[model samples]
Target chain A: MVEIQNTPPHADAEFHHHHAHATTSRHEHGHHLLQVSHLSVGFRMYDIDAPFLSAEQRTVNVIDDLSISVHEGEIVAVVGASGSGKTLLADCIMGLFEPNAEVRGEIWFDGEPMDAMDLAAARGHGISLVPQGVSHLNPLMRVGRQVDGFGYSRAEQTERTARRDKLFSRYGLAPEVAQLYPHELSGGMARRVLLCTALMDDPKLIIADEPTPGLDLDLAVAALDDFRSFADEGGGVLLITHDIELALRVADRVAVFKDGTVVEETAVANFASPDLLEHPFSRALWHALPEHGFSANDQDHPIPIQSTAFEQGGSSDGGDATC
Target chain B: MLEALSITFGYAKGDKPLYEDYSLEVAPGERVALVAPSGRGKTTLCRLLAGYERPWSGEVLCDGSPLPSSGTCPVQLIGQHPELAVDPRLRMEKTLAEAGDVSDELLAALGIRQEWMRRYPHELSGGELQRFCIARAVTCRPHYLIADEVSTMLDALTQAQIWHFLLNWQAESGAGLVLVSHSPALVERVATRKVLIG
Candidate 1:
């Protein structure tokens, strides 16, 4: 995996818009991997009234002047309330936005201007994205083949196979699952497969959009840990999530987006401070967190060996409170 | 009352059985929480209770009678992912309408607005969509509701509001609530009794 060293050129520094109010600017190594400047995406509507033509371009801006940077080897989590442009930002990053939607501003990778419509080009230059849904994989394709895409050389094959196993273990999945199709896998398994494919290319930056949106705590933590490991290993991670618990727990730095603007950005070291909860919106979000009876330590506690489905009466062991 | 007796089921080809033999009973107006590690059949049990799937063995009893497969059962199951619950092609209004008439009370209780009804699934946020899914689940007026992480995506305030609405609905309707969540605090707040699954 280390043989594919992505020494991509640094994008122009002018594209990064540093917020005047940003308190901490301690970025990880590697120059700005991606820089978005004065970017805004919107669409036109045919139903709008026009002077002559029946069709009109009604601009519904999904993301406005959304400038965020992911340096090499850093986990930057984009946290926001749902419908707050988090996914749209991710879509723009992945070049998956609709053609009808007019996208302004520039997305640069490795000091190169990224063509917004070309996912393959974006993917080739050390960039891969795992979508919100695991449906990114071809339903008919086996997980192994889905992850082990064709490349040019013998080394590429070896790398792909090695990376596949690494991902399977990193994501807490068994190697045998490589033979299963997307539909054959469980929700969690499907997600791991999507993540494996994203990591298979060893991209300089990996973007995960709500990677654990609806998963249980145990699974959510495990998924985040996998992403964190990637970041720890000199790779960049852009996490798009609405879950503050995850942002607080896993993100090294956080950017809060509201109505297409970056409302707040704080280092996770200071996440528990009153300043983090002081923002009205963040406060509203904080209060909504479940008072799950267990504390953070409890949340991370490893599952005991006794925890298995078979132990409980197949279907009839009436619900029991006893552990 | 909702009761399951020695239910056993697994995917047709899958060698691992999700439920070997599991039984659970929830009395009227009881709020039970089912907690377990991931992939431990918490969802399968909810499906059986909700009548979305049948148990390979044993029978599901609703109100002391065997649950009928053809019609809407007395139980509703809300999966962890709200996006999966709502059809992508349908608007929120139509999604709610599928349950029956959309009442203002239900809309307000869910913090959803009349304007939202016109929007598509892609337009709504994760939190809003989840609430809408919950409202739709209750549209048939099921006697028992199996909420599988309905509030998983929601922020704190919205979760509290939803919990309040659910508690009030349970009290007023005298319906049982079977909640599945990994959040211990959530279980504490809404679950009268907590059942831990492996």
Candidate 2:
């Protein structure tokens, strides 16, 4: 069910490049590239009596009072504990949600108002998603085909092939990897391919969810640097991760996510010290860094970024985790 | 001691061996870090030690005996992706049940909530799902544990919590550990001695 399918392009997946100015920027969050304001998402319980046949009963709010913005050429990181409903926000942006879900938000992207349909329609044109796990890659398809993505004419396919090869080579992945299945590829190679797929689209906004797990130090940093390059090219990124330290390295601003909502959104420079931070949990997260002694004094709220290095190795390449 | 004796390994389709004459040893209660840059065969070696994969020429022996082919293996492996190791259709509690008699203390230490048990693996985040895997493995009381990048995707706070519990568990159980980690800070704290694998 998780297999990659030949992706059919949305009816308007082409380069629209319109500002489509918002009649009412309700939150006054600036005319940023991506603005999410007062977003409230909840899941309704299925009717216990009717079960499969009935709709919602009670709404359990998952994300409430969430407001965040990403300006052009800026990477806004939404850092939170894993499973703290961060992906729900990305899902809201991407217009993916369960049938029993209740979502309420005013999202403006590229100066246009967005509901679920607008967000769904904007995918891969105005925005692209670098999804979390390698399983997002289609197992049956060749690495190159998936990276090129679906919905292209033969001529466009050929062009995508060329760009895919170029992107592959850029990541130090062998060009031959295009012909290989996902199972045949190593974990690191799979991650790079995922990143390459997001990069190939050249969308105005890229939302990457938990993208650094399988990478090595240099490669993880390299991936972050790639996002920087994307932002430098006048794009925007909503980088969602549990790694605050990694996020601090590249993000211009940080939005600390708590139980289903953002508790604080501040500049990365505020991480200079805990005193500069506004939230108690955010301060605890600062102290939780490995350099800060890896303390999880707040037992209920425990999460961290990566700093461990493989202290020894011979000459190395970045293609795979398994030889 | 757990020993990988003169192992020569290569994927069946590959033209060359990934590891040739590679030997390593871990005595009981020793926490060994397998450190290397990416694509250096660190994970492959983990597979060999845990009896998940067989070496072409050499053998993995534990306590002067070959690892058992069936039954509960003494070498329990906690792989990188917890989703891969769990069944999608089953609830979390059912999957944990497959591991047999998991203690309440183990559950509490990992910060696993009772509510989480009813959900499927896909419903939980990677960090939360991984806690179940660690609980299942540790409950077996294996003589050795192989942790391959166990906490890479987790937050620093959760990463610290998991490792703290692991180190304490290892000390109490005196189970040897063979781990692959990307964090030097973690390696500095967890590994007693590190083996470099290329």
Candidate 3:
């Protein structure tokens, strides 16, 4: 169950000032963005001790003791088979994990520990996470208000507002969408809006979990570009997803998770070669790329990233076959 | 038969229609892939076919019978986002059961054993949830199953497995399959025929 709560502060003045200072050092190279060490999370099962009834619960370890670092301006993708607990790992990073579940991890941002950080503190200090879907945004708020609602520091308001418009232009979303609720916007537009919201905060690190799941190839690429641009602007990104093809395209380095553990971590450039994905299962995953897109050409061929306005010889009209 | 006659649609009170004068037909046992670039109303069309949303103009006829304009229709729509398909609180068994009957035999065939029934949606992996969603849709025995980008989030191996499972189920159940995908590469592999929508 999701234990969503509104709790008061666990830290005050000095901590806030510390995080505030860290937030200002956005372009400082000496500041390490995120350092996660010895992270472990497990769930409790009541049925574990019970011998009666059909109900059997076991202490399931969703994310085992793990540690990985994501530096500023780099895109690190977590890739794994389905059921590998990739999303669970992401939930921990975003501080949304269930309270009952035990999470033992040290998350440090610019040398400051985040173990005691609350959601408000995290949000206020420039950590923005884009959850899995367009629905992740508030459905009731107009898209524009939501983008403007990143709750930036009083000093950064003007800069954030200016950044907001830049993001809209980069993503090719119509200016009119600022007034529409998330439900009213098209699927792609909603995704762009969420991206804009994340960008508006100007966070040093952005963790996006499967941000472009069902979008078409062109739109998916555009969405990836949106994140890449964020990273290019000196923000680190921890992207958790299951699409290896996508990881290869957008990730600088990729981590492979299996059964709640990161079994392998390497650069995307090494993913295609035989030595890169060494595990039998990962090799099998690589071999399984459906033949159509890459059969005539090698998988290494640069994927064509079409801008939103470009004509791909496909229909712009809503009908007459363009799937 | 799954037929839409001149369907026109957009958001409520919206003047700019996303799609206007759109029509399509899928015969029984036909595996038709609706291909379109993003933002071309693929999901809107899927919602129309599944009767989750109403069309501003025109009609969606399933098996030559008119579908309800608004409200839950008999059609089952499996969206591209697996994360949204299953409720967080419900156990896998309860979730699958809500979709419809799940025979012990069907569960095993889909590789979801009895043990998996006790786990919550959050406990399952992306691939596991994807398979579960497919199983749930098939269990409903819908006349027409609309799978929108069902494999988009999956890795290559997992996606291949999903395609195989869907193909085998379609063969056995003989339900009309309306698959909407952005990958032309994927369509060529699974679809018997393709409908391109822009």
Candidate closest to the true structure, highest DockQ = 2
DockQ value for model 2: 0.30
Ranking by DockQ: 2, 1, 3
Q: Which stretches of model 3 miss by more than 4 angstroms?
A: A1-35, A48-59, A94-97, A105-127, A133-193, A199-201, A292-323, B5-23, B50-76, B81-101, B118-130, B140-144, B173-175
Q: Rate the local accuracy (lDDT) of all candidates.
A: 0.68, 0.76, 0.67
Q: Candidate 2, residues B86-141: lDDT per residue as tens digits?
A: 99899889999987988888898887776678777766667777899999999888
lDDT tens digits, residue span A1-323, model 2: 01122322212111111111111111122356777888887766543335565654655666787887776776788887665667778878988877877788788887788878888888877789887656788888887888887888999989999998888888889989889998887767777788788878778889998777666666777778878887877788899887777787778778888766788877777778888777887887887777776776663443322111110110111001111
Residue A90, candidate 3: C-alpha displacement in angstroms: 3.0
Better of 1 and 3 by lDDT: 1
Alpha carbon lDDT at A271, candidate 3: 58
Off by over 4 Å in 1: A1-31, A48-55, A106-120, A132-134, A151-193, A292-323, B6-17, B68-72, B83-91, B119-126, B155-157
Residues B1-198, model 1: lDDT tens digits? 799888888887468678778888999899999888776778888888888888888889999998775777678887776777889899888988888886887877666766567676665565667778878877878899999877666544556667777888889999999998767777877789988765
Score chain A of each prediction against the true chain A by TM-score and list the results. Answer: 0.72, 0.76, 0.72
User: What are the candidates' interface root-mean-square deviations?
Assistant: 16.9, 12.1, 15.4
**Candidate 2: TM-score?**
0.81
Question: Per-residue lDDT for A179 in model 3?
Answer: 76
